[model samples]
Target: MRAKHNVLLVTNDHVSTLTGMADNTITVSALDRTKVKINGQEGVGRDLSLHAVATGKEYVHETSKDDLWFFFDVEVASNPALAGVAGFTTFVMILFIISYWNSAGSSTALVLVALQILCFFCINPYLIALSDWRNFMTEEAEALMHSSVGMNKALKSVLTLIVLLTISIFAFLMLKSVLPDRSIQDMGDWELWVAMLFDSASLTLPFICFGLYTSLPLQVVQILASFPFLFMIFFSTTFSPGAGLEGVKGLRFLFARFYLWCVIPGVMEGMEDCPKDNLTLYTVLSGCLGLFLFLGLQGVLYVVEMNKANAAAADFKALQGSDEFKQLQVEMKYVHTDGTPRGFGQTGVDYKDGYEATATEDSTITVSGGAEPPANEL
Candidate 1:
């Protein structure tokens, strides 16, 4: 009677016995941090962001991937206030520069195209010697002069730039040949994607120009400098006019306003004055903004690091002037074991093993000491 009142709980399972068809699947994959060498990786990282590499540097904090488009991949120590102000100002100025080019007529673009071509062919190798920026190259190049490191870096940079320019030139031509006449503008996936590529080059150009100047390891530079575009690549999922990530309309308009201002806000501000149909608007606009930011940080890092190098040099010079080396002081001076006397200022120290040397008034160099008797010998 008590057993009949026992409670029962039921869970879903095979009662009569049923076998569910399944595939035994296993997945395995692996990834590791890629080795990268920048001009002082930590230094470059610090310049790019305000974060400290040290565990305990006070009053400095890093701003990581907070911005929509800006990022510093490495941890770098810098004054937080200075970094904030510089980054903000540079970002604003970039917008303005893009605005200027957005309205510039086809003539300006034509001139730039020609100049870039000239830079690739005629002026690329001599690039490292032509300006103050190239000064960074001097230290490293001097360190590895005539060695494989320098030669390999040089070849890599040249080849990479050639490839970039080829892609740029080809993109330029594709846009020029495909666009409609300049009355009313219509943009589609082809135009948008091409323009994005064209504009994305802006981010890479400064790294190429200055990085080559320093002959930093180009293999890493090639990979890292490509990141800006690579990051924005999600925007290129499609080439259609309506293609873009979902967002507020107001935000889109605001961005469009900025883009037009950069792409072709027409000095006056109308669709006609706007970027309209010009693709290089996309190119010059983003590129110029990227150039501004790069230049700002580059200028800062160059001056700061250079000052450090100079300060270190000065400290070394001061150390060399210390009194320890006044007369090249010796650890031990030699005198005859039999207590023979030699006049002061007459002893000459010889570097020979097992002997101390002295010069007599005859000007003949002589060894004045004998080797200790060996306890064990051949």
Candidate 2:
């Protein structure tokens, strides 16, 4: 086994010398190995080497420790895809879930989602570590400690416990999609039914889950699909999970396993002989915070993507009307300089003169004020 070195050196000096040699002198030795060679070739030799350096000044040195957080943050921010995806998800969830807190009865699920978002912001390292762990674990096959079906059942049960959680999320998105008129005094019975139907359709997770199981061709679909819910889990664990306990209780079993195995244990460790409210509060608040953070990030991402799309459209429009494109169009026509349309080589200088004169005249006209008289004539 080769030994690894953990060397920490710091110097505030211009010159320093450290040497390790026998008797402070260089020497060499050789050994003969004819005893084990079938070819009878001797395999021992000696070489003497001298190394020297001159320094102009003296300096001091000290050993210092490196901050680990700097590297961790660097790794997190350096991955463009991860940062963008995480940030966007956080933004969108926050905006969608919490932006309308003033209206209607805020459900346990929304509160939980908001708490989860808060958690995500707080548990930055844990999120990164978990992400890395998944990537690493995917490369190797291991014993299945848990079942997917069981996890799904647990999730369904948990989600069922939370009131109007799905409806709110779906309704928020549907409203955005439909942009309802504010002047309407009230929704007609049919309109309300239609909106509810739309919300129900939007909130339907079966299709998304089924898509994950059936339609999605990508290898990472499962991972991506789990991203939103897992982030909720992460947030719940991090922030105050008080108001969101019912929501956490609603999380499917497989997703809740981590909270049961890890987050609960940590929280328990922190709170010795604590009351039930503390537990509820911790769970709900933590979850809501994480959800909020994730959605908030997602909202920002939506705006960013929208802006990018707009900018791209504007650029395309600009290119379409650009001078270069117009020039290309004119060149393609190959209209002879003469006013009369003719083949490429048929035009004379008189034709060229007329074309140039017309072009100049057209160029000089202003919309607000027509072309001025020639300076010499004025």
Q: Tell me, by TM-score, which candidate is best.
A: 1
Q: Model 1's lDDT to the true fold? A: 0.37
Q: What residue pairs are clashing in model 1?
A: 46-76, 51-76, 189-239, 202-287, 264-274, 264-275, 266-273
Tally clashing residue pairs in candidate 1.
7
Question: Backbone collision count in every prediction?
Answer: 7, 69
Residue 15 miss distance in model 2 (angstroms): 85
- Across 1-378, the per-residue lDDT of candidate 2 in tens digits comes to 001112334344411221111012222333443222111222211110110101012222221222223323433436453555455545755575456444332232333334334433322332233333333333331232122322333333243222224333444453333323331113222333333332222222322332322233334443553454545445334244333455653443222222322222224344223334333333343334433554676689789999999997786566645554343323323232232333333222222233322322222211223356565432
RMSD, every candidate, angstroms: 27.6, 30.5
Model 2 segments beyond 4 Å from truth? 1-218, 224-281, 287-290, 323-378
Error of 2 at 141 (Å): 38
How well does candidate 2 score on lDDT at residue 51?
A: 7
Q: Could you give candidate 1's per-residue lDDT for residues 1-378 as a string of tens digits?
A: 011222333345532111111011111223322322222232122211211111122232232333211211211133243244345434533443444333323443333334333323332332322233234434544453322333434544554455455544443444443333241133333443444344435544555655654445654555655555444334322112234546522222212222422332122132222344554454456555545666788799899999999997786566445443221112112223333322333323322224332222212233346354333321
